[model samples]
Target: MRTLVSRLAVALLGLTLVAALAEPVPAQKRGGTLTIVRPTDPVSLEPNLETTAPGAWVYFNMLEGLLTLDEKMQIKPVLATSYEVMSPTKVRFKLRPGVKFHDGTPFNAAAVKFTYDRALHGTPPARWASLAGSLAGAEAVDDLTVDILTREPYGPILRTLAMYCMGIVSPAAVQRLGADFSRAPVGTGPFKFVEWKTNTHVIIERHADYWGDKALVDRVIFKVVPEEGARMIALQTGDADMVLFPSPAQLPALRRDPKYTVHETTGIRVVFVGMHAGLPPLDDVRVRQALLHAVDRQAILDNIMEGSAGPARGVLAPGVFGYKDMQLDRVYPFDRARARALLGKAGFTPGPDGIGGGQGAVPRVGHGVPAAPRQPAQPPSVHAGLGDVERGCRLLALRALPFEAGAAGRVEHVAV
Candidate 1:
């Protein structure tokens, strides 16, 4: 009996020890407010009418389309459960069931058709019409099936549909709100529009009854802080949870600080110097080719851009579909010797008097080419305040004209 009692006591002690040793399970973080800083406020909450990236940034959380682009630019399913390309000109989509707009309107094939019809034929038409590229029409096969037709074999139709402008809106809400829809947008998204004080800030709240995954954050605030310095200060002072478009100058310091994380990605836009081929000297193919060869793109990237910008090889970036790999060195060989040889071949002989054309010929100084049709002239205020042109003229006067090759058919330290 004593042995039995001792065994029960030991078992009771083990149970107590087990209870004491076990770690407590943590509760999931479900509710918090996130504040984002932007240089500008969104022009409109309605994705279809919005054009600016700042507008899209805000609308993306409140609106969604049948498809979305992944990091690799590949199309991924969103509202649509599955899709099949029937032919080059036709595609079919199977919509996800039980999805409803914020206004409680059903999200169906009818909604898709209505959205596309408005985009294609509505007054003030969609800005992304070019992306849609010859969209014939969209038809509802049934409540959940949609058939989309293109005029020809349009390759970018799927991508176009994935655009923010193509986001499906409630037909009932559009009818009820009419022109006021931009102020109060209602969509089947993770977030619902709350208020947008134009030029100041846009606020959104989490959709509690969201169809798919629930949003972890309770609210999101997009505050406009135009100045980059102001944005950095906001981040430092904990006034902002996140900031967009921090200046490249501040990146080194931001990266060094352990309190924050810095992310870098190649941008979609390309910035290149444009010269008028219709103008004198530039009209010559050899002169144009020589100018390209003379530019040290690597040096410019390193020194001016602080290695933040990448040298553009082709007209389009590499990730873009149908991009062709070109040997950049062969095309624009960054060789001053080659540039001098090419310039001489084009009959551009620099004179002792520091002119590029010939002994008596001088460079034309005014606007090099005719302005485009309907181009407006500078305002009197702008013309009076302009100092850049004078500075440019001074720089041009100081620059040495492209000189001719000597013994080795190579010129050194030639400036333009």
Candidate 2:
């Protein structure tokens, strides 16, 4: 009797929290529309087809995932009332009983199964199918009970489900709309899709029948202002409430403004350069080591990033799963003598004309070369061309180099 009462009390508490969230926002903090700007438009609004952040920025408002990450990055249930690991490769979920999609269809275990099936094996596979990660199948055992089976005992399953792409959608709406579903998204979230004007803006309105917390704003407008100056101007003129990823140079002015607040949050993005070790000069290991010793990573981080960025170790950032820190002392040290010696050992030395050349020598750039320091240990050959540039410009610069340069690519999702 005691155990039964405790379980019932916990269920009642959860219901109370849900009911409290459904109440309207207080009059003092309600009714205005919030407007923001993005650097570019989303490729597609359909959660399954889109693989970019712009799409996620808009869709997140209109969908609810089975699980969600809290401010501390811990997994917490959203659509799912509770879940249990039935076995090494299987899991079971108990759905919240009264939730409904924006279009009036009931939200249940069946809807969850349908969403995952469409994502994994629909007419065309979802763009990020690998995000499911070793999942073999999901099935509805009852209206509110679901069983998920994976090919292995995947530890990141809860985190994967928390991603915006895994948000559940109304099966009836999806079947009715087919390919057009991208434009007519229907889910159980605080906001409902209103309209999207290509290259211009996307609009969403508060869902009055939302199962969770009511939206604080009446509407949200995501406008596309590609130019950095234009985005700042919009914020200054009160045309936009927020702007995404403003350039580093703009921070000083924004930080000093008394009327506005600046929010600097931790993110998990890393930027690094890749070398083509198979090509001519780079094919030599000594040449690669020489180049690594010739560059100053700290100077770039301080001057170009204005101190917002940190020098990269390996490819992965700190605190990510499986990350092992590279010992800085053991890695290549910035020594000009060592770089020159390596080049000479590989049969390269400076000619009378002052340009570095010999058998198998890497060509040297003359202009903008920093004067060699008095100490032989200091590197003076690192190029200024390395500072942040556009994708097209970076590719062009790389192609123009004597060595082959690859285009910049984005690093997708990360797990912990």
Candidate 3:
């Protein structure tokens, strides 16, 4: 009874907090619209089956995962309010009471079992194996609880669970909706899927009956404007509330204006061109270094990006664990002379006729190189590219989706 009272008290506090947060939401209260820009399209909404970049992050917000992450980036309670590890391989979940999917299906132990089963037997499992399979099996202990078994002592099991791949879905909804599920996600999130017009926009209405604090915004409208300049223009013209990944060049224009404010957040996404290593000239380390060095990093920052982009040091962006700043070692110094020398060393000296190297055709370096008489021309495919909560679930899902992949590729569903 005391624990119940404590839960009630916390619930009341969350309600109060919701009001406190919403009270001053001037723009949100107006309920005009929020045109959010997210790169790429969603492949599918079957939580365990999502593979695209946007789908993984967005679905987590629209769905609930078994495990969750806290604001401090620690793993915490989400769908299963609490758990007991009977043994290293065995664990139990205490489901949150009264939570329901948009389809009105109860989010219970059976649902948990079904969700993970699909995850282990899904298409994108390879990308999310750790998070989705921390539990080898799940059994409904009761209507409101379930038990899970892990194959091994996965070190980051809980953290992995806090990813979109581990997000829970309804068995009923999956059966009824099938592949169309992504178009109308029905998680217990603060927002419910309202409508989506492919390549145009997506609209999500705030869920007033949310288990946690109700969202401050009445609605979130994700707009699909591809160009960097157009996104800022929308904000400037009051057509958009926020822009997700603004190009660097537009920073100055925004800074010079009063109606717009740019919020730059450094995240765990590395934004850099991936040159195919197998490509001819590029195959040479000197060539990669030369090309990178030839391009003025400082100029790109100053002219194109307006210094807003965090200087990428390594493959992984900042905030990611084990990421090291190896830019200095990996990148060549910004010296035209060095670039010229490197090119020359490769047997390609700039002769009076602007060509060189006793070679056959400018050796195609990376994925797609023009076919030389001696070599075949081809392009390599290097471009390929998580979740939570009940109340804790929402928190974890949003946090994990914090970074922006930027406008990397064509708008597709599964970025994986």
User: What is every candidate's alpha-carbon RMSD to the true fold?
Assistant: 17.3, 12.3, 13.4
- Evaluate residue 355 in candidate 1 and report its C-alpha lDDT on the 0 to 100 scale: 46
In candidate 3, what are the lDDT values of residues 1-416, reduced to their tens digit?
A: 00000000000000000000001224434334445664445555545445545565456667777777664456777777887777777777799999988778888888888877776756655445553545576788999878777788755556666765666777898789877876777787777888877767777887777787777668777767766567656655667655544544445554455543333335444444455565455567775555445544444434333444445566654455455777643455456667656665665554444434444233222122211110110011111100000000011111123122213422211111
Q: Which stretches in model 1 have alpha-carbon errors above 4 Å?
A: 1-28, 267-304, 327-330, 333-416
lDDT of 3: 0.52
lDDT of 2 by residue, 1-416 (tens): 00000000000000000000011224447778888876778777878877666788888888888898775567889999899999988889899889999999999988999988888887677876876788776899999999888889999787778776888889999889887889769999899999999989999999999988898889999899877678767766677766664545656655565544444443434433345555555567876676566556565544544444555554554534444557442486656677768767776666564444576234322211111111011112134321111011111222111122123332211100
TM-score top scorer: 2
TM-score attained by model 3:
0.65
Q: Evaluate all candidate structures by whole-model CA lDDT and list the values in order.
A: 0.62, 0.62, 0.52
Cα lDDT for residue 125, candidate 3: 50
lDDT-better candidate, 2 vs 3: 2
